[model samples]
Target: MKNASAINGYEMFVIQMLFSGAAAGFIYPTFLIRSTEGAYWIPIAVWIAGALLSSWLYSRMLARLEDNKLIVVIRSSLGTIWASILCLPALLFLFGALIVMLRAYSEIITMTMLPTTPISFLNGMLLAPASLALAGMMPIVRAARVFFLLALTCTLALLILGFSDIDWTLGTPLLRTNGDFLLDKHFYAGSFLWMGFTITSLIGSYRMQSARRAWKSYVIALFCALPFIAGYVYLPIMTFGRELSQRLTFPFVSKMDSIYHYWVVFENMTAIFVSVTMLYVLLIMALQLHALGETIKSLMPRAKTGLIYVIIFIVVYSVATYLSSWRAVEQIVFITVGIRLYMMFVFPLLGMAVLAFAQRRGGKGNEI
Candidate 1:
């Protein structure tokens, strides 16, 4: 090899996109957002199906390119003329989603937990770390790994602390079928959380160095994800029956407080636990910002990509800051996901078919 770069582009791309890509902070909130709309069960089930379809699409995108995040893959194979066109919509949607998360999360803190604190203070408090992390992708990823572990441990603690108190009787007879309206609601809610994982396949382009790099990564990733998914699923089932679970926002947080521990230091352990969990969410947003920066630099070399990242950062925070409450943020979240469905689904199929064509032509396709 003639002098490989210090941070291989693939690794760099992966590092930036990995921390938050899989978790998809903006997209995951859609479950709650859609839940607010009243379909209750259908949206969740649709979401679960979406995750499966997304996984297939993701795998195909992986087949389309050797490495680099989706943005790079598009530019390389599709050509900048076409790629840039495709990219514009992505930037607005993804960037908008990021803002929605910022606003919603900040509101969650101020409204639910810190009623006395000013919104500006809450936004600044959260933005400082996100800004610091976005400035350096590598350190931010490392921090995310640490935060992931901490979040995992805290989740386990929550399970142990709260499980016994959950009245098993309360959730009995999980009506295999909610009424016509509610059945639709349940499916979409289930799927909404999984939909955020689509970015993993996009970023997995870089993480998966080879078809057979290591089994451990898959195991570890799966293990980590199960707890996160199960915990969310568990809280709604254990805390509120299907009917009430459908009605609540932040069901997990409500259940945490319902578990009474007289000796426990805080009466509202949910707020503390939830606050910590938001750090995990911040790690996700930082990663996306970094990926956007790297992708812009790779494709549009004349423009300073960091400046683009800064502009995006400003846009996301500005929109978030202007949003007065979490409810408005929630509406934006679902609509975004609904809009992404078409692109997210179609892009992978196109990439896969073209890549297959490239492979048949001996792994060459108008290399950028």
Candidate 2:
């Protein structure tokens, strides 16, 4: 493990800690979007429920294993080969998620922001930033903190503006006429992104400080997440209602276009919002990419971590870029993230149990 200079002060760590949670939350909107195969909130509602379950497991992991990282906890308690094997789903999901996010964001940028720019060139633009982020995990995390704030601002701006352009009458239809198609698809696929919160549980805490302000960090996490849910799901439901929100490709931006501030100089505010959103999503993707890359590198010290990270970014994003159809991408998300989240729930719970046993065996003198 890199000698982590523990981020000091509970409050500072509290702020930093919550960013992950917030970052996790931001992915939900994208998750809901990609997973939005049927109905309105069914999948999302399931996702939120699963997320809360993950949160419960997270606290268990934190409480029982005071010192070990998630990878170590898994390898030691679950057996290295088995744990590593289990990690495949997460690795694939992480890689796929990052790839898909980049492509989707680039697509969003192309569609909304840089209409004239070719996707190939726009995708290439992500390299430097992604590389720079992967090169230094801490710095990327720090950058994420800033980006999280910016993303939040943009989301709020979206809510304020969404009301302007969106036709409120769209909410009129039955929320979901179904008992069947909605149940089968929306409940199953739509909530894939809410699994983003699992990052906090899976990656383990990097910048550990005194556990004094843990509650504060938890509070911050909840605070960060609620607004994100609001932005991705709540705002859309409010603005476009059940009928139109499911139809819109980029519902957030679509809502943004409805409201206009004639005095505002920018011709397309959706473009600006998307760019800001992309930056935030990029920060998150970089962090997850770095975390997994770092963990694997820690296990294999001889490898150049930077090169590995770059390779990973390229490979995943390339596949994402290749995903030509929206449906294909959505289905992939269901399989990948759904599988990752299943492991997230299982291994973390197992780790917590084993750590608790280990702690009892050691008589609590040392948690590591």
Candidate 3:
């Protein structure tokens, strides 16, 4: 593991921003719109609240452990047997997320940019992530830092340009929908969008300087992403109305398509939006793959990092290829929502318990 000093607060912020930004785009807006209808903002609010709470819980655990990696702390508090057992779900969660994201992005690319190209050809894009993961952590962090400015600029520009079509009245009577919708299974299912702050937990130990900075970075990143997320969800509904927006698969992209730019070089702004978003998604997949490799190394100390990444690449590629159609991929995405919720809530509680156990045992020197 690299020293915490190697990673500064700004880099940490950029990493969180990249992950959260990518997640905020794409299918998340669709899930939020479909689940909440007119009351879509309600779930967005709930998601933000849930994310703050989760980040707080994780920050507390990090502080108590004196900045040790979560996997190490888990093993120390619970014996290797129990720690390995707990890690099983986490491993599954990471891999499941990887598969779902890979399939989702590929499906979108096949529909948008490469309609005539074979799905397999589009899936080859996984090689980018595979190469990044194999290169190790520093390269990924550097890439995030380098691209963060351009990506944020373009995204904000797109959002600003999109405001011309907004109709404030479309989101009226925000909570008029049936209250039961808030408690529905799909409501919490969409929490993954905001709950992406949890990505900090996976990579936090690497370049984390202090728990306070980490927490602040997370909070700031969430706020930074708020406008874009809101624009992604509400802009579509405001432009197309809730009824029509709900029916469309990718309403935000569709919203972009509806905009015509006569003075611009590219006739379809959705193409530009897709291109920018694709860069962010590639970073996300690479980060997930790196997290999977770290998880495996924690369990088997002797595992070769290269071999671990190769195995992950093969598994993800094979599964994504097998689930060839949109319906199959959608099912996988819905199924993993439950898994994501489990990890979001359970892991933090487990961390608190582990911290308490360690404290009772007078294990103050447990810092990794």
Candidate 4:
């Protein structure tokens, strides 16, 4: 690993791109399509506004830390006991994301390309990311850069191809909503799509960077992903009416299979979609594992970090493999909805409050 300062806003941007891309493929659209009867974009718009607000608070919290780890900064602001209590939910959030991601992607593979492949074997995909996570953040960033290029090119081509066979009339009621999604649990479950800012905060602070710059990078990355996210949900709805689109598990993949072009080189568009999304999923999984490792190290400075990474890999992989069905993956995500909401909205506010209190009391206030 290199100095944490070596990580810059652009590197963070690329990583966020991967996180957003993976969500576009896996769970985000399913939840959105099911949660609303009117305009799907309304729920998306609401979530984006929520994400931007939470990200602003997080950047403010990071600004006060300079080059300190978030947990370490909180410990300096508050006592060890209070810091640990505040940080535990974040740790659980990371672990829950890992479980849901690993299981969900494996289930996707089974449903798409490799129907005969065993779930346990497909779940072994975590080993690659776990190894990279142990190697440290720089490697993951470098890998994200490479994967982002390939994944972006492939993804853009597919999105273009998806426009070939759509009936615009089927998409009537393009922009109608009565705010029904506000009461849906699936709407809350979709918060995972907007969690890139929160996840990257675990990497500690960048050297000499302003909070505004970090926040802007995330904002840009997320907005750039709007087409991909919107296309994933709406493209399928336009192709197959909402009723049929809601029934399919991987709607975009089904949309891809529906695309038939005489000039196109590929025989199977579904395979292309699955393969490209795999790159995004694997890289983001590595990012999550790295975040989890860093959080545990901050909490227990004396523990062997390598051993900690191994234990995390083993535990997450085992649980993900043993999940009985795809329904279980969604259930776990639904169960963790409260924790995700806390991390998104409450955690940053609490961190900022503690820092302000410590500075007022003249305790480690001048360190930054």
Candidate 5:
């Protein structure tokens, strides 16, 4: 890829924030509420901490290797065989994320807006962003910039509008469970919420001006997403209480429905919330498909981009449609949480080890 066509730090920041923020709109809150029960804040904190640590480590690796893509760094440091082996999990993690999120968003739409509309139709609508992705990374990044401001405005508006119904007292017993919750098997399951940081590895090769600036953009994006994520989980608990919030399909949407917007045209703000979130989801799916295409190109340099996209679209659309029910989608998502956790934490450390080994063998000259 030419340096001129690559995305800058601000564009990367916008894309990452939109991708991560989309998780906040739908799945993350549900997982946090389910796993932590009354102590959802503890898990949320853990996920954020994990995200920051991974981002820092990833940035350090990017600086040391000076490669635009993590796959290139891995291939350079570890050779083709080992690098391909390592990349398999990362690819699966990306594809798994695509499947889970595609179904999750479709489920949300069916439950909220189009009760009678088939999920197959919703899944097909999602491909709209894939068309942009087919044009290449620049289009996806530019689209992210366009959608970022509008998404941020609508998200903040919903949060501010929902504050009127927040019952702070419902958040009692902050530490309902003991510290054991931190070590619980499911603690890291929330990692999916913060997996947006992985975009650094995916897009790092896209000509970031400075590692320092790129890191700053990453940190800023995380902070930008904090309020929305925290509110997505906490606001609902504060509004509906722990038990009821946990029971609802989407407590955040429920919270939005409870709010009355006098000046707004739509009687229920949940529709607007869904519309904005759908945009976010579309961008995320585009990025995922883009990542899949890039990974395939990296593996088979001679492969056609059109064929790669077709395969990705087929796999994603087939899996998403065949899931048949929300419960099935939930099961797949739960299974992939482990894979996501591995990619988020262990994969980068492995890359660090490869870099260290390569540096020891050839010193600075062989770093890239």
Candidate 6:
């Protein structure tokens, strides 16, 4: 593993973009399409604003701890018992996310390209990320840079192609929103798409990286990802209309399958779409696994780190491999909505509070 000092804000940006692409393509659009009767952009706008606020607060918290990383500061300030208690939800959210994504993509591959393939063999894709996560952050960052270029280029091309047959009429109710999605669970379930900052924050030791630089990287990446998220939702609605788009499980995949441009050489756009998305998924999985492993190590500092990662890989792989259906994956996402929200909105504020209290106590002791 290269030193943590070698990691930088740009690397974090690439990692965030990878996470956004991975979530945006497969499951998120369906939730957004179903969440509101008004313009799909309303829910998206609301969520993007919320994501920016959450990331800003998180960056400020990191800024306050100029000398130590979040995990180390939390451990010293809150004590091991309290820090473990605080981070329990983070652990749950990461683990649940990993399972949902692994199974969801595995199901997609089965339905789209490999009807007769065993799901167990498909889930084995996690093995690559698991090995990289165990190797550490720099390795993951290096891998993410490569995947980002390939995945981004292919995804943008698909989105452009999506514009070919879209009917502007089907996109009616463009500026309307009644805040109906506020009551819908699925709206909140789509939070995974905007959680790049939270995921990167868990990678300890920013070292020489500043909070300002990190926040800038995150915001830029978020804007860069806007089209993917917007295209994934609106393209399908424009192509098939709202009523039909919501009914489809993987709307973007269906959209890809429907495209018939002669200039496009690939006979099966679905296969190409899935292949590129797999690259995004693998890198994001490594990020999640690394975050989960880091949290566990902080909580149990004496435990063997390799053993922790190995056990994590086994449990996640086994559960994901045996998942019965796509419905089950969605159910898991629904169940974790509360955890994800707390991680996004509440966790950073709580961490900041703890840090402030710690700093005050340290000041008093110094004065004494």
Root-mean-square deviation (CA) per prediction: 5.4, 4.8, 2.8, 2.0, 2.7, 1.5
- In angstroms, the error of model 2 at 89 is 2.0
Clashing pairs in 6: none
- lDDT by residue (1-368, candidate 5, tens digit) is 43312456788789778977777777767767766654667667766788888877776666666545667766766777877898888888878888888888889888888999988888896578679778777777778888899999889988888788778888876777666656644455567777776754665363234555676787898887788888898898998888887788788988888888577677878888999998899888888878777776776667898988888888888989999788787777768877887777788788778877776788656775
lDDT of 4 by residue, 1-368 (tens): 56454566788789888999988786788888889898888889899999999998898888877677888778776767788899999988999999998888888889888999999999999999999988888888899988888899999999988888899887768788889999998899899999999998877564236566778889999999999899899899999999998898878878888888888889899888889988998899998999999888887788999999989998999999888998888898899999999999999999889877866777555654
CA-RMSD of model 6: 1.5
For model 2, residues 31-150, the per-residue Cα lDDT tens digits are 444334344455545555666676556655665546556666555665656766866666766676666666766776766667888666766756755675565645665665666656
Q: What is the lDDT of residue 149 in candidate 2?
A: 59
Model 3 regions lying over 4 Å from their true place:
1-6, 175-178, 204-209, 362-368
Error of 4 at 132 (Å): 0.7
Q: In model 5, where do residues sit more than 4 Å from their true spots? A: 1-6, 175-177, 183-186, 204-209, 261-263, 363-368
Give me the runs in candidate 2 sitting further than 4 Å from their true place. Answer: 1-46, 76-79, 165-182, 190-192, 204-219, 234-241, 298-302, 354-368
Can you write out model 6's per-residue Cα lDDT over 1-368, one digit (the tens) per residue?
45443457688678788888899998999999999999888888898899999999888888887646688789989899999899999999998999999999999999999999999999999999999999888888888887788888999988898899989999879898889999998898898888888987877755325677778888988998887888998888899988899899999899999999887888898999999998999989988999999888977889999999999999999989877888888998999999999999899999999989998999999999
* Model 4 TM-score, 2 decimals: 0.95
Clashing pairs in 4: none
Candidates in order, TM-scores: namely 0.76, 0.77, 0.92, 0.95, 0.91, 0.97
Clashing residue pairs, backbone N/CA/C < 3 A, model 2: 164-258, 164-259, 165-258, 165-259
> lDDT tens string, model 1, 1-368?
11111234334333322333234322343354334333333344544456556655665456445554556656766678777776665565566656755665666676567889876666664455457545665566456556655665665677678675666665443444344433333233223245343433433244344312222233234334554554554555566765666566666666666777778776787786666667666766665565555556656767875577677667766777787667766666545654465446765676667566646655344452
Candidate 2 matches the true fold with a TM-score of 0.77
Ranking by TM-score: 6, 4, 3, 5, 2, 1
**Among all windows of ten consecutive residues in candidate 2, which has the lowest summed lDDT?**
206-215
Tell me which residue pairs clash in candidate 3.
none
Best model per TM-score: 6
lDDT at residue 117 of model 1 (Cα atoms): 86
